[model samples]
Target: MERKVPTGIYGLDELIGGGFRNNSVNMIFGGTGVGKTTFSMQFINYGLNRGEKGIYISMEMTEEQIIRESKQIGWGEIEKHIEKGRLRIIHTHGEDIVILSRFLQDIEEEIGEEEVRLAIDPLTPIIYNVQQKRHRKTISEFFNGLRRFGTSVVTLEEMEGVEMMPLYLADSVIKLQSLGYGERYDRTLRIVKYRGGKHGEGLYPFSIERGLGIVVDVTEEQINRVTPKMKYREYFEDAKRKIRQVEGELREALLNKIEALETSWTRDESPERVLQMFFRTELGREI
Candidate 1:
């Protein structure tokens, strides 16, 4: 049997075939006012449903604010878990990022002792702090440190223009796109990439309401299919091997042309001119 993890999403599990694998850094990125926080709540809710303890790390929202917003979405049951000592909410303090980095370090020490599933809401504060404070070195080290702890982490990131700052760092990058049509808006989620793991492609719609909590409408596949008309890994590997072969041939052809130019000499041209000619001819363009 294939082991699976729960994503705490509505209709998404069927799309990915299962949840995200254990100990992977899963990132959710989008513009402001998207469902990033709600999605975070859903994951914590999933852990709660499974009777696992969870921790909510907030850099912007107060713990009370989180509870209230959750209640508005009918996830007020979150408080019950807190009451049972199954959930912990940590608010971000001064110099937001330094405080939070210290906070994450502290939590790392506590995870094993507490066995808590953690969710860090809105990664903007962390990125902003690093940029404003010139802590690029520390930020990367911090991310790698957290991954070393081997816990399920979902961090929310905000993207503007075409930047890969945090996206390049995460093991999995999930993009939540928000679209407005007429007077209504919709949110969609897609895995931009999943390192060392498999995921579904394209966008999947999501919705949230007080009574329904959160829901996703996506495609489904036969999870039990034992036979295949095609096997992706084997076929994809073959394609890659062929592409490598073509690239090698092109590279060797270029090298041979360069060597051929070195053997030819023109006595009429100056030394500099001769070298330039060799470069242009061998490169097949202006060098």
Candidate 2:
């Protein structure tokens, strides 16, 4: 079998069975601040590092803005790659078919020389120009043109669970979400589907740090860190098991509190504190 294209995002490659298939289009859907842009940039940079040319087509951000954001996230060498002609970043402000066609033309021409890693950030704007029925046909043809050169990744905005037009067209789909549970937000990444590849299912908690970018934890222990329900349930189970050792009305009261544990409490307060509070109050001692 041919080798797959590495995304360069740690832990993600393993989920999709050793990265993406070459000459394939992968769809990445995420809401605001869910690290879609950063991930795409990282993918391009990774390809560049491996001595492969890359092209980043943006419908929203300028070249200067992309360079600035990439630098902030420790991907400062983007400019250097561009300088060496190993990378190309294009911001297509065009909204119509003709303009989009021209943008595709540039990409086709660039990829003619060598195998390149391509990223189309927020592919929504380009495809949204046409009607819904025409969207599938138009977008499909556009992506088909891209595949003749190299593998590509297209980022899209999640439309509140609505069926996106691009999701059906891409070879692989990666969905990202940021849920505000507890005192702060928890980010998650899930592989929706990877055609002809074995992928891990379910939401895996991920963090977007400054230098690290996006890192996902597939292990049970690491997953428990950001999984509120799982983490709290473990805490509840431990307390429940221990509470059984105590006798009489005190134990009964603790049981009631455990059953009464609300989602808000699990999120706002620490689960360990719930048991500690009961111990301190009933036992007349701090734990």
Candidate 3:
């Protein structure tokens, strides 16, 4: 079996055969306000929490804007991760293809042999800046460089009639669609392709929550059938209050994780079991 890198988004891993294939380049395309950036950030944050490094290269937003927006969506540890050398964020500001290529080389050198997760938000700037004749070569080289950094998730804006070359180069492709029908199921996710693994078929309903980035509504009926009825929100709140008792950085990290769980806790296991696991992993102690 191929080594899998777990995507931090709740309920997404099980759909893509336990996460993305290790060292593979994945592409996510979506229209505006369709949760593409959130998906990429969640992938990077997931790696950072597990002691893996991450690099976020943004062509649109600045470092300050990214940090502020991330905190607004409940990823409080992004600044802390950067301070501790676990994460690095770069803003290209629509730089040319040459400068972007140089940035990738410098990152590869800095990472050395350590595996790192990479996120490039809206790759349209870099790829579209080049000539049409060079699109194939540029995309091929760019995808190859991303693979060296371990696993990567790159986002692209969904244009009406434009053909995206990255879609063909990527090992996996996930397309996020916004139906705009103003219903509960306005947004949906579809796995367009997974090179070597079987993935869930059909469009899955999803929502972009405040704390939780993108929660894919998969396996809800199965979880409901197996798990007993309980007040998940009440239990999550109690855990949050307890987490507030701790001081300093650990407290902030714990609270962030708990808040995300509060928004998308749909597992078959009880919340108490999940809380215990968090305590043991983060605090190195039993609750």
Candidate 4:
């Protein structure tokens, strides 16, 4: 089995096929105020709770600022973790970054730690200020340096109209988007890439709460209310009939997928979600 690590964000791991691959580097990118920093902090806290040491290297925020914000979100134990040396927060000034590759090499040489969870918040500052000719090479080298500490999550600020180099180098990519302003705004997350898992695609709604942190918006109550096994049998037969009604080429494809779905049911996978995906993708309708 591929070793995986939980992201600690509610309802997200299941969508990404059971968290991230261990020892892999993942990148989270978003516009300003889109919760990249909060997500990164939550990831570190989750690992800390799991008895794993964590490191957070911030370019835009001070160690105190990070602790203060973490406290605001009810992560009171953050200070204790720091005091006990379970977590280390590093502040890298966002000064000249012309030689960011060399800078990262120096930082990695300084730490000399292995297999720790690392989060670099706002990697954009350094990469953004680097000279254009060496952009991709520099970004690749920075990621190579991060691997010295094991599985890493790097957060980057999304420039208004510029494509970032780190987005392509990371093992996986998660994008957060909050559109509009104020009460009418909508927040969504997309797993743009997951290197080795059958992850869910497209946008998923999510919200940030005081105690819960990031929670994916799931319509379980309205759409996935559990039914007894006898009722499931009835639905299963009905699904078979519906699949039979599909036209030639699509019918063959649905049959193959439905067989997989049948096996999934035995594993206690969400029948509602499977059926919904069937309807949405195969039939272009909803359950």
Point to the candidate with the largest lDDT: 3
Measured with C-alpha atoms, the lDDT of residue 275 in candidate 4 is: 78
lDDT of 4 by residue, 153-176 (tens): 888788775556678889899999
Model 1 compared with the native: what TM-score? Answer: 0.68
From the highest lDDT down, the ranking of the candidates is 3, 2, 4, 1
Residue 120, model 1: Cα distance from true site in angstroms = 0.9
Clashing pairs in 1: none
Model 1 lDDT tens row, 1-287: 23456787776666554676565567888877778888788887888878988878887789899999988888878889989978888887435456546756787765665455567777666666556454555656667656655445556556563235777777777888777753223677777887743456656667776655557766434222211223233433333343344444665665454333332221223334544554466545434
lDDT of each: 0.64, 0.78, 0.83, 0.77
Q: Taking the tens digit of each residue's C-alpha lDDT, what string does model 3 give over 5-69? A: 99998888877757899999999999988999999999999899888999998988898999998
TM-score order of candidates, top first:
3, 4, 2, 1
Listed in order, each prediction's TM-score against the native is: 0.68, 0.72, 0.74, 0.72
* Model 2 worst lDDT window (10 residues): 222-231
Question: lDDT of candidate 1 vs native?
Answer: 0.64
Candidate 3 pairs with clashing backbones = none
- Please give, for residues 109-219, the per-residue lDDT of candidate 2 as tens digits: 776768899999988776566545566787788878778778998899887644587788899999999887732237888888888645667678887778768877677
Clash pairs of candidate 2?
Answer: none
Worst 10 residues of 4 by lDDT: 222-231
RMSD to truth, every model: 13.2, 14.9, 14.5, 8.3
